[model samples]
Target: MGFFEKYLTLWVALCILVGVTLGYFFPDGFQFLGQIQIAQINLPVAVLVWLMIIPMLIKIDLKALSGVSKFARGMGVTLFINWAVKPFSMALLAWFFIGYLFRPYLPQDQIESYIAGLIILAAAPCTAMVFVWSNLMDGEPHFTLSQVALNDVIMIFTFAPLVGLLLGLSSITVPWDTLFLSVIIYIVIPLVIANSWRSLVLKQKDGDEKLTDLINKITPYSLSALLLTLVLLFGFQGIQIVTKPIIILLLSIPILIQVIFNSG
Candidate 1:
């Protein structure tokens, strides 16, 4: 692993701190950046997501996508975990930690809201970041792409109903625009651009060598964009983090448990 990858945890910690501090001191700037959104998706973060995933996507050979059928078992397991396990498990963790164990410390009125937030978070599987993670693990690129695409499709049908079921609500408002716009921005556009660029690069005389060199050159930018994204994310929540440290910490316990459990 390279230095950046080797110390990614440390770098992430530092970025969180930097983001929080900057946000607290210069709230206006971060708020301005935050407001640049459409369908509740932040444009700056969307751009960074594009930078983060495009290099990994470029490495994917769309022609090899037909071979993804060989991993049907793995895909089935992923879907099972994502749809059948994650949301309910997260709701259970939220009930334990936020709704029960830490009840005395939390505002009774907001307990339901907190649990709902965790359920919503867990119900939606990640999309763009899957590529970055798969790249870091040196995983199968085609499988990762296919898996993310499948998850997105399943999420479209299942997210609102699942969340409504877990939250005990009769009907939940699903942001249809956000869902479709996110797919277009994160998957469709990036895939098209990356494959087009890959094809163009492969037409050169020293095609393979040039492509390899180009990917190497752009990989750092991808990682850098990831770090920047972390900064922006933390920055957006800096005020709540600073003012309600204990509440934030307590809320994080269920989320942390949910992530570890689902990922495991």
Candidate 2:
């Protein structure tokens, strides 16, 4: 790994600290940035997401999509974990710990919201960041791309209903419109742009060379954009993180469990 990739965790930690500090000092600026949203998706973060996701997607060879079947076993495992296990298991964990065990310790009104957030977080698998993980693990690119594509399709259909079911079971209100909008904004649009750009790149005279050069040029920027996105995300949540450190820690139990469980 290169220096930036090798020390990503340190960089991210520093960015989080910087983001929180800036956010705490400039609440109005951050709030204004946060308010520039459409359909509940923040505009600046959307741009950064595009910058981060598009370059990664550019590395994908859609022609290799046909070879995805060769890695059926790996894809199947990913599907089972991401769809069948992660969300439901997270819901159960949220209910057991947040609903029952941590009830008295957490804020009364926000308890349901907290659990709802956890359910939402786990409802869909990681999309863009999976590329980074696949690289880190020396995983097959075709398998990673295909698995992500399949998960995206499944998520489009299942994410809302599954979330609604789990949240209803937990008696939490479902924000249907916002959820759908998020899928469109985050998943649908980025996929289209990435593939479109890929097609354009491949149409050039020296297609492969052009694509490689383009990817090399923009790849570094992708990580930089990711760091910026993290800053904005942390900035938006800065006050909450500061004020409700204990609640944040408690609410994170299900997420920690889910990660450990899935990674195993």
Candidate 3:
């Protein structure tokens, strides 16, 4: 592993502390950033996400997509876990932990909302971060890209209904704009930019060597962007995190459990 990848946990922890501290000290600045959003999607974070994923995306070979069929069984398992198991399991966890176990600790008014939020979070699988994870694990880039793309597509159709079912709502207002825009900004745009850049570089002299050099040059920036993103995220929730540490801890337990459960 590279140096940054090797100590990524430390970097993430430091970033979170810095973000919270900065947010607490300079609330106005972070608030200004927080308000720079469209359809509730933060633009600056989107840009950071682009930076984090584009280098990884650049390494993908579009021709490899044709061979994705070879991973059918693996893909099937991923799809089943994502669509079938994850959301429902999270809903159950939320109910058991939030609605029942931790009910006395949480505000009565926000219990349902908390449950709903967890369900929504579980329903929408990670997209851009998958690249970072795949990179860290030395995962197959082609499979990672294809799986993420497929999940994005499935999320569009299933997200609202799954949330509604879990939340006991007959209908839910899906954030169509946020969903579509996120896909465009995070996936479609990055993929296009990466592949176009890849094609251009490969047409040059000593193409493969040049491409490796370019990716190596930019890899640090990708990881840096990830750290910045973490800072921004923690900054956004700094006050809340500080004031409601217990609540945050309680909420996080299920999320942590869910991640471990799903991974296992």
Give lDDT per model, in order: 0.92, 0.81, 0.93
lDDT score of residue 102 within candidate 1: 99
Question: Mind sharing the TM-score for model 2?
Answer: 0.86
Enumerate residue pairs that collide in model 2.
Answer: none
| Candidate 3 residue pairs that clash | none
List, residue by residue over 38-86, the lDDT tens digit for candidate 2. Answer: 8677889878877876676667677777887888888888889998999
lDDT of 1 by residue, 54-141 (tens): 9899999899999999999999999999988998899899999998999999988999999899899999999988899888888898
lDDT of 2 at 230: 85
Window of ten residues with lowest summed lDDT in model 3 = 132-141
Candidate 1 local distance difference test against the native: 0.92
**lDDT (Cα, 0-100) at 57 in candidate 2:** 68
Q: Give the distance in Å from residue 51's predicted Cα in candidate 2 to where it truly belongs.
A: 1.3
Among all candidates shown, the one with the greatest lDDT: 3
Q: Is candidate 2 or candidate 3 better by TM-score?
A: 3
- How high is the lDDT of residue 245 in model 3? 91
